[model samples]
Structures are given as structure tokens and as C-alpha cells.
Target: MATTTNDTTYTESELEAEKTAGSRSALAMARRGAFYLSLGLAAAMTVLFLPDLLALLVMGWTAEAGAELGIHRLHVMGIAAVVGAFLLGLFVQAYKPRERIASMWGAFLVILTASVGTVWFGVGRPEEVLPFLAVTGIALVAHPAGRRLLRRGNSYSPALLGLVAVAAIPILAFAATQLSMSSSTVDPHALDGHYVMMTALLIAPIAYGLFAALGFDGWRLASWFAALPIAYYGLLSIAFPAQVGSTGAMWGVAAICWAIAFVAVAEYSRTETSSMLRREVGHSS
Candidate 1:
């Protein structure tokens, strides 16, 4: 009886170990899938949208378009900035799938919401929306599943929390502005310039802030966010005063954004260097 019982116990242990190993293998596969999907989507979006930015750049330089066209160019640039921020998040999620699982969520939500909104509103071709919907849906499932398998703890730094708080100002203001614009019965699609501005005002801060809060890199997005307003609203306003008028309030907000960007970059660099040094030390030891 005792010998029989020992044999059964050994068999059960072996089965349990194999089950755990198989689960880990599955999670690894899911994580890789999430990474490739996120990156491929980013590349696809860039390919899709790069033409718009390039066309605007060519027109601005070759034609020497006046204030009317100049403002339009700024609008295109703002839209590019927002897209760039989303791409950055995707890149982070791709490179560090485990560490930035939340980033994958952010990227997935952005694409899914945009896709659904476009389809529902008849603003985009139904066929065109299918790819985005399919990719994000797969990621939404894979990323969270993989993250659950890893079961990592969340840590929030004080500085990054502060950054989120600062970013909320613009985000909230942008939301209110969007509501006001909608109330006025203005056609959002017809005015690309205003659409891009409001979109940037809402998207950049929220996306980057979420990234920072989740312990992913925030500096790149922060720099992009700050650069748009500073370059388009502050500096370009001087060159094309009639088209992009300089307002005291705009400049003030731009300055604040610049400060936030600088701090984020500095903090990220410091932490990254420290981590690299620690890895080297561990390897040496």
C-alpha cells in the first residue's frame, strides 16, 4: 500500500510541474505576439499618415505658402505630434512587453476607440477600420493575459505622479474646449486645423501622463507635446503673426509644458543610466 501511494504522489508532482511549465511557455508566446502586434500597428499607422505630413512640408517649403496655408501646416504638424506620441507608446510596449503592459492597454484603447469612432460616425471607410479593430482586439486579450501570468507589482514615483498632475491641466482644458466647440455646432472634420489642435491638446497629455504613471518612458512623448505648442504656437506665431497669433496665455502654457518635458527627460535619463550600471555590475560580479 505504501509503495503504491508513493508512485501515485510522484506522478501527480510530475504532472503539476509540466502544467506549470506549459503555462509559462504559453504566456511567453502571448507576450511576443503582443509585442509584434503593437509595433506592426505603429509602423502601419506611420505609413498611412506619413504622406499627409510630407505633403504639408513640401507645400510649405516649395510654395512658400502664406499665413493661410502656414496655419494649415501647423495643424498637420500637431496631428503628427499626437500620432508620434501614440507610436512612442507602442514602441515602448513592443520593446518591454512585461514592464509596460499598461502601455499596450493605452495603445490598444487609443486604436480601438479611434477605429470604432471612425466607423460609427461614417468618417472612415468600414473596410479600412477592420485591420485596426482586429489587431487591437487580439492585443487586448494577449497583453492582459500575459501580464496576469507575470504578476508584477506596480510602483509609482512621486516625480512621475507630479508630472501627471501637471499634464492634467491641459487635458482638462482641452476636454472643455472640445465640449464648447461641439456645442457651437461646428463641423470638426471640415476644420482640420482646429480638429488637430484640440486632438493634440487632449491626447498627448493623457497618453504621456499614463505612460509616466505606469513606469514607462515619458520623456519622448513629453518632448513632443512641449515642442508642438512651443514650436507652432510660440515660435511660429512670431514668424506668421497674422496666421498664428501669439497670446500671453498660450506662451505661458507652453513654458509650463517645456519645464515638464525637461524634467521628465532628465529623470528618465538618470534612472536609465542607473539601471544600466546596475546590470553591468551584476554581470561583472
Candidate 2:
């Protein structure tokens, strides 16, 4: 009879403990979601206002409120906010992830996939030579053969490190091409998108590469800066397609980058929570 009572008491205690743990976990997730939502709002507000603020300053200098310059024309600014939110989200949410260099697969995959799409679309054009080179360079880094070279003790295998460096050359050149605004110089498309493509496509990939190479420290803020702005920019391309240059391709890159980063961040959070639970179990045992 005593043993039966003791067993019931222990079972009740276990249930209570589980309930507490579950509550804590749910609260933590809720708090995290709220924080990201707040950051998203902040980003959106900044994008909506900052450019107009700049325009206000310019107007102060010239004393002209040109019809072309106003807060309402903040399509790119909205996109910038998404970039901020995305970057900051990663830093906060990716508190703990798998230690393996394999965690960076998403980082390299980002550029690799985009470059492949570019090559596929522009294969016959002489202008696509740079993107073609970039496709080769990125493929070397993202392919399984390159990842297989990563050693157990090393942060990055020598071969993988070397490939990343070699890959940088072509990628950098491709980014330069994206930012050169040549399309605008000849056809005037830059003014329409306001370098949204430059920030999202050209800058974010480089930031991710740096983040991965640096072992995800010291360069986090940069990664955030590269990421968060693209959401709004990507939206603009979809909503106002006629206004954005290379609209379809640019949208694809933005979507893929955002999705990959989000998945990485979520994985990090899940791993962290699992580790915490394990530690707690160990302590109790």
C-alpha cells in the first residue's frame, strides 16, 4: 500500500515537472516571436521614413520639394527594413547551432543556386561570362567534394578554405557587375529600384560568406545588414514588377536567401533548446 502511494506521488510530481518545463518552453518561444515581430516593425518604419528624411535634408539645401522626392516613394526603404530584421533575427535566434562547418551549407548554397539560375538564363550572351565563372567557382565550394575535405579538428579544411578564397574572386566580380548600374547608365533602370538589387543580391551573399568564414562571430551585424532589407525589396519586385529591373531573377534570389537564413536560424534555436534540456536532465540525474 505504501509503495502504491509513493508511486502515485512520484508520477504526479513528474507530470507537474513536465508541465512547468512545457510552459517555460512555450513562453520562451512566444517572447522570441514577439521580439522578431517588433524588429520587423522597426525595420519597416525606418525604411518608410529614412529616405524621406534624407530627401528633406536635400530639400533644405536646395529649398525645393520636387514632386519626385517624398516619403511616399519609399519602396526601397521598406525593403531595407526587411534586411535589418532578417540579419538581427539570425544573430538572436541562431544562439546555438551544430558546431560542424556543415552548418554553413546554406550560406554557400545561396550564391551557388542564384548563380546557376543566372547562367541558365543568360547562357548565350557574352555579358553572362562573369556569372558563368561565378557558377563554376561557387559550385566548387558548395559541392559535396568540397565539403568532404572539411577535417574533424579544423574549422575549415585547407581545401575548402582555398576554394572559398578562389570562389571569392568570381563572386566579387559578379557583385561588382550587379552594382555597376550599367543597366541604368544605358537604359536608366537603377533609379526605379534604388539599388535594392545591389543590397539584396550583391551585398548579402558576400556578408554570408564572411560570416561563414569567420565561424559566425565578429561579422554578425554585417550579415544582418546584408539580409533584413531584402524582404521589402523582394516584395516591391513582386507588387510593382514593372518598376524593378530583372524583376523575376532578383525576386528568386531574395526569396531563397531569406528562406535559407530562416531555416538556419530555426535549426539553431531548436538545437539550443535540445542542448539545454539535455543539460537539465543530466543535472537532475
Candidate 3:
């Protein structure tokens, strides 16, 4: 027979181990929650917006037939591209929630930024803003949000930084032009949606690239998320030169070039790092 001298007794290491296990369990659930939430949101957004994309594809830009309709279609396509890029990131996060935590955070940033922009501008209906706010809250509860932002070992490639700088020029120019517009310049009816699109255009690339550059494992994947939306703007401008003007077309071309360069740099860096790691492992053996 054995009896404990104290009613309860536990070593410090045992307590630490138990606490660690609990933390891991919570993180695991959070990751799973992030995955499911991302997937669900992706599916819903796709269903909601895919029709608009398909309509654009099927009807063609010429179908709009009027200045208002044509401009509205452009706005729709711009918004659609942003949403599509966002959904793509969510799908990526859902694929491997643990490994792709950066993308998960990127998803949260998109929603949060959009929510704030819409609310601040008084652009969308209460229903729209509320849903995004709720989603931002739910996403925040998943994992330790923004913990990676505090990591000290994060590194940025000079080449990638250069690309970001170049890309930002046109982005800043476009932002300035949009912001300078008044009710007299742009149709008051379209102002809200236009501002909302501008927010996405301005925020998505910076947000995704910032997180990806902050020591994320899948910088190559993140490059696509950052580059593609900007590429959309370029493509739109080029395809509708009559609408966007010669200067806009030039900017669009520059954007496309930047996207290509950014992806190439990311891919080259990833390949070089992998090759170096294999060489080190081989030498060690």
C-alpha cells in the first residue's frame, strides 16, 4: 500500500510539460479552425463573385455599351480580381494551415482592411460591414494572430524589396489620383464602390508582401498572392486603353513587368536556398 504525504504534489517540469501540452492542443485547434474558416469563406466568396467574373468573360467588355455601365463593369472587374486573389490566398491557407500561417494572417488582413475601409468611407451597407467585422473577430481568435509580426529573425531579400519599391510607385500614383477626386469629378453614385476597390488595390499587395517577407516559409507562394492582383490592374488598363488612357496603359505595362520580376526573384531565391541546403547536408554526411 502507498499513500501520498501531501494531498497534491507535482514537479515543476511535470507542470511545465502539462502546460505545454495544453498550449499545443489549443494551437492545433486554432489551426484547424483557421483552415475550416478559410475554406468556408473561400467557397462562399467564390460562389458570390464567380458569377460576376463569368459574366464578364461571357458578355465581354463591349456589352456594357454606356459610359456608366462600362465604368461600373471596370469597377466590378477590379473588385472581382481583388476578391478572387483574396479567395486564392484563403484556399492556400486552407491547404496547410500549420505551414501556411502567413497566408492565414494575410486572409485576416484582407478582411480587416476591407472592413475598416468600408466602414470609414461609409461605403457599404451595415449588413456587409458587420459580416466582415464578425469574420475579422473569428479569424483573430484563430492561432496567435500577429505573433509572427514580432519575430526578430525575419529577413527580406534586397531584390524583393526593390520590386516592392518599384511596384509602389504606380500604386501610390493611382492612390493619389483617386484620393484627389471630388464629388464633382467622379459620379457620387459610384464613389463608394470605387473607394472600396481602391482600398483593396492599395492594401492587398502591401499586406501580403509584408507578412511574406517577415520570415514566412512559403515566400514563393506568397509572391503570387501579392503580384497577381496588381497584374489584374495592369491587364485591365491595357485591355481597356480607351477607358484608362495612354498613361494608365503605361502604368499597367509597368505593373505587369513588376509582377513578373517579383515572382522570378522569389522563385530564384527559393531554388538557391534549397540547393545550398542540399549541398550542406551532403557535405555533412
Candidate 4:
């Protein structure tokens, strides 16, 4: 009778432990899901507003409001709030590497410098449009840094890394070309060709990189998210042919698409890794 009683106790204890483990696993999965969702939302927002953001930056060159107030205090404040919230969400979802954060900050600083340069040199020092060159230069430098931080300790996936590098190069090059030409005396029609060329250059590589990262699931989600910007740019190109002639709008659209694609791929890869870890845990148990 005592042995039977002891057996009963052992069974109950094991059941309790299993239940606790299951609960913890559920919570962890939930957290990961939330993180992916947050990332997706942030990327989507970036895509939706990117055209306007670029427009604002370009207009900052000519608009009195941009020159005097700097990106309109309200827009700047809004972007800040959005970026803060996105970063906070990402932090809550995962323990990101310090290098990844550094890379992100580096990119932000470069972009900010370019925006400020647009306003400062708009009228007074058109030659200073050269400062805008830093945007792509910084991004090119930061991409490797970010990849290094992200891939640290993990077995290197050469194909994936290569894809990312390939996608980024065109973007950086296009941005540099645009910056260089912005200072020249090119006609609007010619400038439009530059914009179209840059956009065309980015589309295939960025899509491929995202596919490698996310696999089919990620590609599907990212593709749906990517469509919005493509449509927006299509309309903008058609409606305001003269105003949207610059490469600025095209680059902005491509950046938005790539950003969303990258985030989607990252989330999918993270989830796959987590799943593998969980399987290892289960096998050990």
C-alpha cells in the first residue's frame, strides 16, 4: 500500500512538471510571435511612409518650411515616436546583439545627417549636397557590421550572407549616384531615368535576399506587404511625372520594400532557429 501511495505521488509530481514546462514553452512562443508581428508592423509602416519621407527630404531642399524648421518639427517628432516604439517592441521580443543595435543606430545617424545636409545646403551651399553622399556610404559600411553582429557564433550561411551583400550594393551605389547627380545640372527627364534605373536595380536582388531569409512563408507575407509601395510609386510616377522625376522617390520606394523584406526574412529565420532549439530540448527531455 505504501509503495502504491509513493507511485501516485511520483506520477502527480511528474504531471505538474510537464504542465509547468508546457506553460513556459507556450509563453516563449507567444513572445516570439509578438516580436515577429511587431517587426512586420514596423516594416510595413516604413514602407507606407517612405515615399513621403523621401519627398520631404527632397523638398527640404526647396521648401521654406523644411529649410527653416527642419523636416517640419511635427514630422520629425512623429518619426521619432514611431522608431522608438518599434525599437522598444523589438527589445521586448528578443535579446538582440549589441552589434545589431549599433548598426541600426549607425544607419539612423547617416540618414539623419543626409536629411540635415539637404536642408542646410539647399540654398546657401549647393556644393554641400555632397554631404548627402554619406547616406549610402554609411549604409554600405553598416551592412557588414550588422551582418557580423547578427551572424556571430552561428554557423555561417554563405549563400544568405552573399545574397544580403548583393542586395545592399546596388542600393548604396544608387544612392551615391543620386547624390552626385543632385549637384549637377541634369534635366528632369534624364533625372527620371536615373530614378527608374535605381529602382530596377534593387528589385530583383532585394526580393531574392528576402526569399532566402524567410523561405516561402516569409516571402508570401513580405510580398503582400511590398505591394503597397510598388502601387504607390506606380501612381506617383504616373500622376506627377514632372515632380517625381528624381531618383529620390524611386530610391525611397525601393528602400521601403527592402526594409520590409529584410525584417520578414529575419523573423522567419529567428523562428526557425527557435524551433530547432525547442526540438533539441524535447529530445533531451
Q: Report the lDDT tens digits of candidate 2 across residue range 1-285.
A: 122444464466677787899997786566555534543544454465444543442242242433353432333333334233332423232333233233233333443433443343332122322332343333334333233424322221222233235535744665566556533544333434334333334444444434443333322333344334344345445544544333554654654456356335433533454432112312332
lDDT-best of 2 and 3: 3
In candidate 1, what residue range of length 10 has the lowest lDDT sum?
276-285
lDDT on C-alpha atoms for all candidate structures: 0.48, 0.39, 0.60, 0.39
- Report the error of model 3 at residue 94, Å: 1.3
Q: Model 4 misses residue 106 by how many Å?
A: 3.5
**Which is the winner by lDDT between candidate 1 and candidate 2?**
1
**lDDT per residue (tens digit) for residues 1-285 in model 3:** 333337867777777788999999897787667746846764675566366564553254565433445555555566666666666666665455456665655666776766665666656444554464465455545644346524423345556666666666767676556544413235652355465555566567766665565546555577778888777778777877665222477878987887887777777776675432112212332
Could you tell me how far off, in angstroms, the CA of residue 43 lies in candidate 1 after the best superposition? 2.1
* Cα lDDT of model 4 by residue, 60-106, tens digit: 34556445644232223223322332233223222332333333332
- Residue 10, candidate 4: alpha-carbon lDDT: 46
Per-residue lDDT of 112 in model 2: 42
Task: List ranges where model 4 is wrong by over 4 Å.
Answer: 1-104, 112-160, 184-242, 245-260, 273-285
Runs in model 3 lying further than 4 Å from the true structure: 1-31, 34-42, 45-50, 53-68, 144-155, 180-186, 244-247, 273-285
Pick by TM-score: 1 or 4, better one: 1
| Alpha-carbon deviation at 257 in model 4, angstroms | 5.3
